[model samples]
Target: MHRIFEFDDIIRAVLQHVESSATDLVNVAMTCSRLAGPALDILWSRQSSLARLIMCLPQDTWEGKVEGCCRDYIVRLSREPTPIEWEHLRANASRVRRLVSIDGFTDAPKLPRGPVLRRRTDGIGSALDLFRPILRPDVIGHVLKRLFEQFPPATLFPNLCELHFEAVFGLLERSSKFWLLRQFISPGLQALRFDITGIPTHEVEQLFAALPTEAHGLRQLSVSAGNGTAALTVPPSLGKLPKLIRLAIFAIDVSLTRQMITNIQQARCLQTLKLNLCGTSCDASGIPLELPSLKTLYLSEGSLSQCTHFLRQVTTRQLSRINISYRGSASPAEVTAFVESLSTSCQTFEHLERIYVVDKSDHPDYLLVIPLHSEIFRPLFKFKRLSSVKFIGIGNFELDDRFLKDVPIAWPSIQELKFISWKRRAFYSVTFTAMMSLAFRCRSLQTLHLTVDATQSTTIPRAPDGTEALWPTQTALRNLHLGYSRVSKVARVPYFLAEVFPTLWSFKFYERYLRNCAADIDLRLALEKAHSQLGALRNSPYENSDKLWENDSDDSGT
Candidate 1:
């Protein structure tokens, strides 16, 4: 035996690499007496379903049958398994650290909306087929509940720590799934993701209220309710969890939002919060809610006023990221108010790094015409540490070269800056000069998306010595997306880009806007030529390729 295998930590570490492949882990386990326990322990640590553990019981204890019009394979419990037969299950059950209950029929044929028909089969089939069959969640729940009646329930899965209970389809009975989930909620459980899409609102409330008592050590919890379902209320008992750090809830109403904020006020350890507000208004009656340790916040499915109202009432100095998505058109005043709320509510702006605001409304006429001025975005300029700023489908921005110049100065560490509008503006004042400003100023920038008027001729800035002011390689920008930006001198554009942003490799444009336009066609061809040249240069063995920018002055029309 090798000395490396003598160390249990080393053995476990080696097994971690092959844990994803069950066959490899099983082979390792059976390879030798020394590797068996650790290999099996690694194999059973995380389980997607309860099918495998149940199959470990005596061969006669349960049987696999292929029945019903859909021809679904299912495992059915025969007589109750005695204590001797339960040993195999108990051994593996003790190793389980995470159990996720997704729908059993995820890959199965979509049957007509009706109860699944079941037919018992004679206990005879291919050994490989009978080895493991998809166990119906409801049947497994029933069998497990029956087994718990005979064996000690508390000791079933002693090491289980994480449980994700998600059932989108209505195949599993509410009672059975909940019962099975409840049995896994031990004091040591750290994370729980409960997607109660089909579960009744009252039942969801009841289960949420019982979580703190059932799993006091829970550090992360996510609850999601389906759209059009009854609104879910946040139970006060959930706030009692001492170590809760992250919480995300979907499809909640205004009243429940207030309740959630009020309940989690003193949860000082809470770091991340995501809420999908369902109501149009989320006014918290002027009373401010403070979360001292919160670092990230995601607000979606609310109106502009509702999201702003919610933001104004919260104070978290440690906030680093905020994502807000709302429906309907937002006026300049509304956008200003939302940005102002962030500037005021967050006492310190140094920690704030990312801000993403997107409009979900689909009406192009109503959404596209709203013009947002640079003054409306001035409030965010104070956050010096801002790295990523993304605004999608909100409205058209009247940005120019001057505003682009100030952006890099304001947010020097900015990496990803996107201003994506759903509709293309007929005319844009921003020219390639704005692009040059970003390439020269923002050193950390990796992704840039803007609508610039490339049709107009603009001179590249020159240094005092009369050379083109270029960062040839310093600029980290790799992806540049020109969104409906008009371009006429396509042949000169690519070479100019190579001179300014040598590292830029991915360039994208809205092709729909290119229909029947000569300039658009030229622009597309120019980009393809640049990509081909870059590919050839990268594949070449030359140490220094001067030909990269040799065609910088190419005037030949595409």
Candidate 2:
């Protein structure tokens, strides 16, 4: 949160950081109705990413020209649309050149056949629909050819360090596709994101063949696969990107063919890697994956049997953070073993600070489950450098009483803690109590995040006699967040946190359940009250909470 100033010049800085804070923008708008348009202007100007704009797809925009659609497409159009309408429309062709963008994308049968409009979203489509104009097949291919042919020749911005193509994977394989991609991205491209949805097999191969072995300048590159079955080959050139820092890729088995692994081995400078082999992936036999500089790694899919091989093969001393996600099914015990073995093998990765093992509970097919085994800290207590932890969505039925025992011994350095359970009774569960006990046990604990399982029904607990257990003693906690699946009354949250974490500074409390989900103001008063309490905690006990709300919020003395 940022303070507001009456003078106009002060806001320019606040706007920079709060661009994504929609609620704060609304409050600023109400302060002066005139501020609404300008504030929106600042926020919408950022719809520059292709992904955000893709969300606007399949939906129509500005019927014909730029209008006030609150969708992503509008954000893609120039936030600074000149006043002269004819001139704006007239320059549509040239602006495409200057900005390196094409308004409409591929076409589908449902979309109208002619020229498309480019407002944000005044039409009827989900955020995902608005990409229709861009998803059109030929249009997508043309955008790719156009990008490669022109970017290398025109990129002049010194401040620009990265180039992100939102749905680049939309383009299919072609003869010169790899060459063209290399032509545009080879040297200057630092950050690249391609969405492979409808791509074909050969094209996938060509894309991989185009990986630049000499990409010494590459830093962060992400290639995603949207909701489509059209699989592509895994490019071996991927591992060869020179000085590659962070890479996020989703590929199928065909790309995992033997030779690509050799290329992967050649890539030794990688730091952070995220790989998702969602569907059937071929055995990654003899694929070279020797990443000595790697630090953080994330993988989705692959059995413990295969994962153990991959982890054992990587001889890197810097590997510290590991996030293993089990999408379809997996056993909690097996997952626990997989993680424990990783710690034992990657001994040089002594800096390992955090580990995240995500499992989906209800998928009966993968009847294998991670036990309500937080107390089964037996596998993890070995890592002396471990710290932060996150459990995304195990239910109450999966956990039991002895789960939280002996957790800190594995990594006495632990400080910040985040626990998210999808189980009901989390607030009242022994597991929750164990979590709290563990939170207080960590002498170095500074930031603690206790989020109830959002998928469950709501149940706020009260003390045995009427008051609720505030929390483990909050004296050591600096940042504490207690969130409900849905927003409750705002007043209830501030009182709870105030009692629990007396020194807490930043708080995000939800309370929209009582009213229309989108328009609820249940927690409005509570936020201001908390802020004043914060002010009081700083030792100014005399300040009035009501007055504090008037000074910062849009509410006037009236």
Candidate 3:
């Protein structure tokens, strides 16, 4: 074979591009011996189910049946496999690096969903009816135990690096799957994620207590207590993971939240931490916790007070991104306090690049009129490197022209800026002129979503000599979402927008903001026409511009 093919790295890289296409990989393996090893390795590197490895055994080793009201596909060992069958299984099992088992099933069963009445002469059923079933936790536990007796658990998948096991069964059913999950854990494992529902709290505690010894090299871990389960306890020994770098816990409570924070301080290498507090409140009167290595933090399903408390305690200068989501309403003072804590926690704002603060509640009656005043957002303005900022589901923002002009100067590197309100307001002070200031100053801005007062007539500014003033065009901006923004003189607005944002393609506004108004409908149609015109102008040559405009007007009339 060629010298390039002799190098395993080159062959592996070539095989990875076609790894998703099993047929092509198989063809390459069968075509050349030099390519076969790498091809087969890539093919089995990531497995979503264990059924393929089981089928590698002798055809008669296992029997399949469709059972239960859900028509779950199940398999049982009819007879023990011999030495030759075991060898076939071992050949491919060693190649797996990532194994994922979701919803207590390895693979989606391909068997017929309709009921089968006929039975074969052997009394099992038709040949086609014997396809793999949705393996239950109990059935999988039995099959895995029997198979492990033939081969040691550690030797089954020695090269496995990542394992994601999720099952949505009840207490007893999930308890059985835990055994199967334990067999997959090895010292070589680096990442593990579990999302089992209805499992007892003690079981979760025990699993984490043993992780340090079972998987010493683990760097990333994520666990979620499925719906209706109690808060997950944070085992003290979980901090013993020497190489742990990323950890995410969902559906945890207040006291355990404090314990979790205290426990993870021992994880010196941790860089990413995510917690879902389930809207529980906690006291913030404690010494600040320092996470020197943490770079990203995400907290969700928390109350405004709870989220503020967590931020106040966390002192991480290296943090680059923070996503905070709370459920209920918050007064202006409470919102300011939360933002103040965030700024104080991050010692230096230079490292912070992205900030996402959202209020997930949608009760219109609870909406508050939080003015978009400079003083309220002064803390966030210190983050010079900020790139993306999103605030969704918040109450009515009393926006004005001054705040809009100040935004560009604060975060010049901003790429995406979104401010969404829950209810429509009758009046807005900010006009189209203020939005143009952002396009002119923040050249890198791409996505912008804000409500502005566009009800005035569209007129191009003129210079002292009576000629139209030249304004800088922003080509990076592609999407503009004006939620619940009122607009009038819609005919000229589209042409004015095309001048400022030459490459703008998407212009969105809510028509339901004023359902009975005729102006809102006209604005939507005008924006639609501008979108079509810009799209065609970009694709066509300059010589065809006139022809395109002619076609645009003809289409607009209809």
Candidate 4:
């Protein structure tokens, strides 16, 4: 007789066996009552929208009479569903572990149909103006109040862990609706993200102040002041959250930078900090702040001097990742100074694994490139454990010869590398011999992203002894992203890549079709076929056959 697995074991098996989709889990819940409890728990755990939950309410609770597209949405607010049993509502709502609020741009469910409110197009430049205007401020407030009043917070969403508001402040700024919605706050909440763009500083402060003291338990908090140049003050209560592990602040002015730095200094457990300096000048008051526990840092859109000052003050030795982005001119000297400072002050850079030097300039014609000076990148080469590196923006440098050749030798453990250049013709004359040099040097490379000119002839390289050179192959490389300058010669890409990267499983080829070419069609079909074939081999039955069918044979040595 075979033994049957326990209910919990079966549930775990179902969830863990494969990547189950939302529909698959819902199907599991409908299978039987024994399996439904756990399946329902997983299904309603992290809801992206509250619209679905609101729709589940009784039909009579919907407000206003309607016609056309909004006819079926009319109902009055009620504690319980009119015809459906209250237990049904309790079953689903009780299992909800998160409620993610959507911004105006999201196509959420219509609340009560009213006048055909035209989208305000006069001064509607912000993303908030794009809302469908279905759930007006008053309607949302009323619904939330009734919902909270009907079911006490403890029973309604006892296991709630995250409450994310994505640019939902447009509706919130009109009134103190957050106060009405405060009852939904749970002690176990781990993450909170608010993109309050147009809201006033005082109102934003009030919203932050009203948060339950459980805010102290939050592990991650991301706040972005969408309005450009408007200083969004950080509430004093948020500064001392002992359990907070990750904090991100964006679009803050110079005056608030001191307070922000002070808060970061106080947060003892913050492991990751991302600050969008919002073009704020670095002042004397913001210096001397320290981050002892920080491991990852992202600084973007700030003056070079300001960024350098902040990095000089912060103290951390365990940092593994650093990303810096700039919208304006980020001269190579400025960037080098920042890195050199870290090399001298921050002891944690020795463990750094990832670094991104990105330039997000507005005008594509105006190029902002980082010149690769040996002295500047010398400290970067010291990152022996570095695995990922990205250099984005146009530069006055050759990517194929010097840059690629030195990178592999310097960072032998590199697994991923990306270079985004403005000159499309940079790779037009690259020879196959030069390309193989990178693979030979960086044996651990897995993901490579850069433009290449496969149109050039595959010239045979000779060794010092005048013998034909044998190119080394990299089996670890799985993902290759290439931007081709010409498509006619793209058909040769598959064969060339197969030789250089034997284990290539994913290939992304980007090309500009100036004029229709037959080879472009072949390239797409070839890549699709390769992807499907590799996918089959990766998920074949033989993958885990040995585990399930153990070797039971016992051979006696005669």
Q: What is the total number of backbone clashes in candidate 1?
A: 0
1-558, model 4: which lDDT tens digit per residue? 113435578667776542135445545544555555676566466554444355444445444434344333332355545434345555567787665543211212212221112112232121012223344222344555555566776677778766665532223334454453455455677777666655556766766765536465677777775533444556666767768877777655554566667766777887878776754465564235567787788776666556666676566777777777666655667767777866754665567888776655556444334454435556777777789876655343235455566788778789877654533223344344455667556888887666555555555557999997756677888766554433234335445566666677666544342226676666555545544444454552111121211211111100
Candidate 1 accuracy as TM-score: 0.81
TM-score to native of every candidate shown: 0.81, 0.54, 0.81, 0.71
Pick out the ten consecutive residues of candidate 2 with the lowest summed lDDT: 549-558
Model 2 Cα lDDT, one tens digit per residue, 226-318: 632333344667777777777766643433434434555566777776665444444554523456677777765544434544564455577
Score each candidate by Cα lDDT: 0.67, 0.46, 0.66, 0.56
lDDT for model 1, on a 0 to 1 scale? 0.67
Tens-place lDDT per residue, model 3, 181-243, is 777678898877777565566776777788999899998787776641446656777778999
Question: Between candidates 2 and 3, which one is better according to lDDT?
Answer: 3
Best by lDDT: 1
lDDT of 1 by residue, 184-235 (tens): 6778988777666656667667777777788889988777666324466667
